[model samples]
Structure formats: structure tokens, C-alpha cells
Target: MTTQTKVSICLPTCNRPDLIVECIESCLAQTHTNIEILIGDDSKDDRTQRMIATRYQHEPRIRYVRNTPSLGQARNVSSLFNRASGGRILLIHDDDYLAVDGVERLVSLWQRHPDLDVAFANQYEVDQAGHVDREASDRLNADFYRTKSAEGLQQPPGRTGLIQMFPNNGWMANADLVRRISYKEQYGMCCDYVFGVELCLAAKQVYYLNEYVSFYRKTDVSISMTTKRSTSAASVSAYAFIEKLRLDRPLEPARKLALRRIVPIVVSVYSRNHDPIKGLRIAAKNLFAYNYGFSMRLYYHLMMISRSMLTLKPR
Candidate 1:
């Protein structure tokens, strides 16, 4: 914690030694000189360890730790969170790479507003061959509400996160804030989402820069692509309670509007998993909570629920 700015790039990687090279290279290529790349490797084999040792052993800026017994994704991230040393920390997935100036840009954002607790920018979507998709990247930002209009300090930052703007990629936070909120296994796939909310809640000033700071790769091996994630009823209930207890009274309407947009997707995912009962349960809970009238959105959800019930796979 010197007067000089130093950023710790906490990267949690597993089994993808070949893919991680680009990520590491990008980190090393950063314009910011004061950075430590902490690589927490959870690979089953020693390939990643050998690769890092062979390429970066002499490098003072990099630290490599291979977990004796694999830490999985959540625990591995928790380990990185605890070991981070810089004033600010950026969490990078193994398959993703930062812009050459990513850390510098993010740090500069904080330097301008020294009291800012968390800062992040939009990201570009890249393919397996590292080709950036302009349209997909723009749509990604738009969908997440990372538009120019939404730039600047977001009050009650939890609402911005609750609405899905705070992503797992391309963000940096104060070391204390990141360490204060450890990863939770109970949230399942939604743990990252919940973590974002917790970080924003802990932060006094959270700013969204309208610039693209990193590349989010869309690979076949990605968690979202390789697996089907079902949002549990427990997760829905927990999110609802979080909104009720933590969100401001004026933000109630905003939360409801956000939930109105998200409920259909949650219900559809449950339906796809052939768990119509759970889907209906969530749908009914929301409908009853708001005493919703028969609007088109309500009708559409009702129809989706009705179709799912008829087509339910037997237990």
C-alpha cells in the first residue's frame, strides 16, 4: 500500500493451459507497470504449472500457485481473493484476456475519483479465433444497460447489479471490498451475480465507464456453453428477499420492473429442465406478490406455464 498505484490481476484458471497463455500474455502486455499476476491453477495435471514455470518462472511480477487438491471454480476464486495484494483487484477468467491498457484504464478511472470503491467498463465479445464481433459486443453492452446514458456513479449500486449490469468479467474493485465479500457456494451459478450485488452494496461509489476494457471470449468450453444451468426456487426466493430487505422503497418499482423482465426467462429455463412444478411455483409466487392483472406480459407467462404443465416429463 505505497503512494504508487499497483493493481493485482487475480486470475483463477483450470486445465486450459493452452488457452490461458493468451490471457497471461495480455496481462503482461498491460501499459500499467506495477501489477502482479497471481495465477491460481486448479488443473488436474501439471501442464499449466509446467507452462507457467517454463515461461514465467524468472518473471518477478507473476506468482503461480497450483492447488494440491483442486479447488474448483468458486473455491479457487475465493483463494485468489484472499491472496490479492494490490490496492485494486481484477478477476479474470482463464479464457478471457484484457485489453493492453485495461488495468491502466481502470486504475485511471479510480485515480480521477479517488474515493470510488468499484469501477468497470464494457467488454467486447471474441470468438475462439480471437475475432471481435462488433454487433454482438454492442448488443451485449446494450442488454446489460452499459449504455452511454447510464455512465457515472450509480446510487444504490445494488439496483444496477440487480438488473444485470455488474458482470463477472472486466471489472476492478478496492482490495478491501473484494476481500470483505467472499464467494458463496449456496448461490450456485448465480453466485457471481450475488457477489456483484454484495460488492456494489459494500461500495460507496460505483462507476461504469462507457469504454471497452477487455475481451470476453465465447468458447465451447465456457461454463454457460457446456452446461445447462437451472435457477433454483431457493435462488429466486433469496433474490426476492434481498430486494425486499436491501433495496430502497423508491427502488421497489425498479426491482419489480427488472423481475418482470427476468421471471419469464427463469420460468422458461425451469420448463426446459422439465421441472414444471418449480416453474409454476415461481410464477405463482410473483403473480400473487403483485396481485397482477391480466396484462399481455402476465398472459404470456401464464401461457408458458400452462404449456409447460401439459408437457411435464414424468418423475
Candidate 2:
């Protein structure tokens, strides 16, 4: 008596011909039949295209697209939505493949809880050869998908709230929710983090599935772990979001205290990975804006102090 909910699995891949087939195959093999797979591949090499044409040419539900160069990940992802034709959308990265029954489980859960804006499942980490690694639990943070409301999301301002809320890997969102809240165009690596945070903050209900529905490939050369600007973009964007939050919402002293602790860590992680100059600049800007006040300023100063200490210390 219920209408079948359609799913659009959006994959934004870069030059992973070897991985592409498996990723698509896993999605195609979903226990849920009412699903469409959309690929927004930006591979400089055409191996992925060749593979799709030769091996996957028979699939009707699969659509593959080649993104023009230099569009970047966030923009490429935006384009994926345009190609989507399902009631719900799942943004699956190229290097990640879903579980055999992942889509079916998600659909069953969503049907039971239509009020939830976002739903995330557990994922495994594997090496290039597809050997699973149990120790790479860091790749899978299940807590982020924990049930949270907009009101309960407020915490004594710091990483505690952010980490507690966004402690996971891939997520499924209501297509309508995404269309209503735009992704920060400039966000590269951290776009997922920023997007997840924004969506969660605005969502009335969120769900966590404590089951591994995907395998996140853990290679030393993966873009996420690399020192690319995309990797550090989330920090800059989060600070920007904090400023917006400060203007839009008023929080208690506890929340403000948490913010103070969070800003420094943001800068510290940014500086260590990407541009120290940009990190310092953001810290100074936020501090002068009095976003979190003197304690946060002190925290950034402490990070610098520690760096200096390490520099001056004998190795």
C-alpha cells in the first residue's frame, strides 16, 4: 500500500578505473531494486570511460558523466544532483563501495522514519587489494550519525558538539533537504564535513545505522589523507559557519566556552597540514572579530607557543 521510494546513488570519482567497476557493481547489486546509479567522474585518464563502455555498457540504470577539468569536487558534486532522478540521494565517493544490502536496509529504515533528514551507516576500511583492516576504525566514526535535534545540538561551544554530531563517514539525505541548503562552493576536502554539519543542524531528525554498508578504501595516496587544500578547506569553512551561527543564533555561556576551545584546534590542524599563514590569518580574524573571545585567542596563541617550543627544543 506504500509507494516505492526510489534511490539515486551519486558517485563522484577521480581516475580510479580499477575501483570504479567494483564500486558500480556493488551499487548495482543492491538488494533494493528501485535505484539509479549516477557517476560524475573527473578522471583525467579515460580508463574509467573505457571500462564502463566495455564491461558496464549493458546496465540501463547506470549513467556515467565526464566532468570538465578544474571544476573541483564541490562543484562536481553540485552537478551530480542535476543528474539525479530518485526520491532520495546517496553521495557515495568513487573509492567507496556500498554493502550488498546497504541500499535495501537504508530504504527500510527511512520508510520507518520519514521524518529523519539524514541517515548514515557503518563502513569498513580496506587496502588497495581489498583486504579489510579492522584497525582503521578512525575512518569510521559512527557517533556523528547519532540521533540529534537542532536544540540538543547546542553544546558548551567547542569541538565536543561538532565531533559528537558528525562522527561518521557516508550519509543519505533527503534530496529536498540538500536543495534547500546549499553546499559552500569553496569547500573542497571538508565540504562533506561542512555539508554534514549544516544538514544536521537544520534537520529535525537524524538516524544512525550501526552496520557496515560500505568499504572506504584506505590507501596512503588517497586524497582525503593527503595534504591538499581540499583537506584543509573544512577548517576555514567551519570558522565561517561559526561567524554565521554567532549572528543567527544566541547560545548560553556553556556553548560559548566550547567554541573557544574549538577554534584553536581548527587552526592547529590547518597549519600542520596546509598553509600556516592562512591558518594564522583565520585565527587572527576570528579573534579580532571576538567570535569566541580572549580564551580562544589564547588557545591559538598557545598553539603557536607550542610550535615555537618544539622548534627551539633539541631533537
Candidate 3:
């Protein structure tokens, strides 16, 4: 008998007892039977534990581990990756959920393309009330499909194309690949983006499926939303990663140009957060060492100065 490929669905959750059950149920209802739902709960309260024990404890496929003290977001996710024992790994955040046959479809695709290292499908962006934002969903789908139709699936999307066709929550990859390219803990808010980029760069072939595999909840309390409200950590992380890529990796001219364009936008995020000093420092570093052209240097300098002036007192 042929051994079936086992998939480990790793869910790193916090204090979202209200939404976690739904996420868990969605995983449990997958059409693929050879799957394990590994939930690493970093919740401050025991609500998640209680809910899992009461509702899903009888299920043999569910394995729930509650960290004694919270492990922060990145570490918790890393822990899940470490604990996963299957041939394939799929990460589903506590607030997000898989479509009924999401895993089955992903597995089917993987079976067809045995050499693929990573696969991602389009996802629905839903509001706090779980209503799909059709406009945003349509736009995302169109962009993804257009890229796939133009590029074709046989060729792996290089760094530049991968950046343009950003993979959201509905991503899956070979288990060994994820273990080898573990999440970088230093990139707090931008870890996912960093992880995805690294995966795409390393993968021999990355596939994009047209199916809507998951629903990503866009709540005001989400990490990205909250980080945007308070600080420029995400931008800082992006800048750091971009610099790392520029310094470490040999990029084609197109990818190099894309990085040059992206640097200023990240700097602008810092400037908007009233962090002109850090932004200027980033701009200066990239300007002098990273070979960012005169236009970008001038733009960052002007933008920082304008932001500084705007924030100045009337006195």
C-alpha cells in the first residue's frame, strides 16, 4: 500500500477563544483525512484550553499544547513548526480558517506536482463580522490570476514577481523545507513576509492555485493593524530584510531595481510614524552603502524634512 502524505496544520494562537473554535472546526472538517491539527496556545487565559478539551478532545487528530507563559507570536509559531511531524506543513492563524476542501485541493496539487517546494492559493479578506470584502477579494484574485496566466506555472516566480504576487494566509509548503528555513524571531511583525520571501527564493518551484483556500479576518485588533497604529516596527523589519537580501543574495537587475523602489516606501512608513530620525538613518545607510541612487536619497531626505516640518510647533 502506498503511504499517504501526512499534513500538519500548525495554528499558533493567542487569546482568541471566540474565534479559535471556528478555525479548529474548519481544519477538522477538511476532506483530507491524513492530517494533524497542532495548536500551540499562547493565550493568557485558559479559555482556549477549555474549549479544545470540551469540544475537540475526543478527536484523535487534534494535538493542543498550551505554553505555561505566553511565547510571543513569532516564537509560538516557530514552536509549532518545530513540533510538526508531517510531510507537509500548513499554517493557519487562530483568527483565520481553511475552506472545507482546502487541504484536499492543496494535496491534490502537490500529488500532481511532486517536485514543488511551496504552494499558495488566494484567500478571502473578511471583516470582523466574518463578511467577505468582495471588492478586495476580487482585486486580489484578479492580480494573482493575471500574474499566473501571464507567467505560467512551469517557471518559478523569481524574487521580483514573487514580491508583486504576495502570498497571504493561504500558504502551504513541504514540512522539511519549513524546518530548514525556520522563522526569524527578530522580525516581529514582518516575520511572515520574510519567511515567505525566503521560501520563494529557496524553492525550486513555487505554485499558485486559483482556489480560495482560506479566509483572513481583518479586524482592528489584528497585529498588522495594531502595529500600524502604534509604531513602524513592520517597516523597520522590512528595511532590515531588504538590506539583508541586498548584502547577502546575488539579485538580478530587475530584482535589484525592485528593492530600490521598495526602500523609499518602507522609509516613508517610518517617516509617517513620526520616526524621521530612524527613517533618515535608514535612508543614509542605504544611500551610502547599498548603492541606492540619487533620486531615492533625495526623496527620503525631502520626505523626512517635510514630515519633521509638519510636526513642528507653531511657536
Local accuracy by lDDT, each model: 0.80, 0.65, 0.75
RMSD of each: 3.2, 6.1, 4.2
lDDT of 2 by residue, 1-315 (tens): 112888888888888888778888899898888888888878898888888888878889888888767357777777887778887888787777888888877667766776766776667778888888775643344333233232222232233234434432456778887656545576656676666666666777666666667787777666555643343545555555555554233333423443454566566665555455655665666573345455655566557745744555354
Measured by TM-score, the strongest candidate is: 1
Residue pairs that clash (backbone atoms under 3 angstroms), model 1? none
Candidate 3 backbone collisions, by pair: none
Rank ordering of all candidates by TM-score, starting from the highest: 1, 3, 2
lDDT by residue for model 3 (1-315), tens: 112889999999999999988898899899888899999999899998999899886899999999998888778888998999999899999999999989887777776777888877778888877899978886866754434454325354456233545464567889998888877888888888778777777778877776678898888887787676335456557656666564224445435555565566666676777767766776666663246455755565666757775896666
Better of 1 and 2 by lDDT: 1
- Candidate 3 wrongly placed segments (more than 4 Å): 1-3, 141-168, 229-232, 246-250, 253-265, 277-304, 307-315
Across residues 114-162, which tens digit of lDDT does each residue of candidate 1 receive?
Answer: 8999998999999998899999999999988899999998877777766
- The alpha-carbon lDDT assigned to residue 152 of candidate 3 equals 27
Q: What is the lDDT of residue 97 in candidate 1?
A: 94
Q: How accurate is candidate 3 locally (lDDT)?
A: 0.75
> What is the overall TM-score of model 3 with all chains considered together?
0.84
Query: How many Å off is the CA of 65 in candidate 1?
Result: 1.1
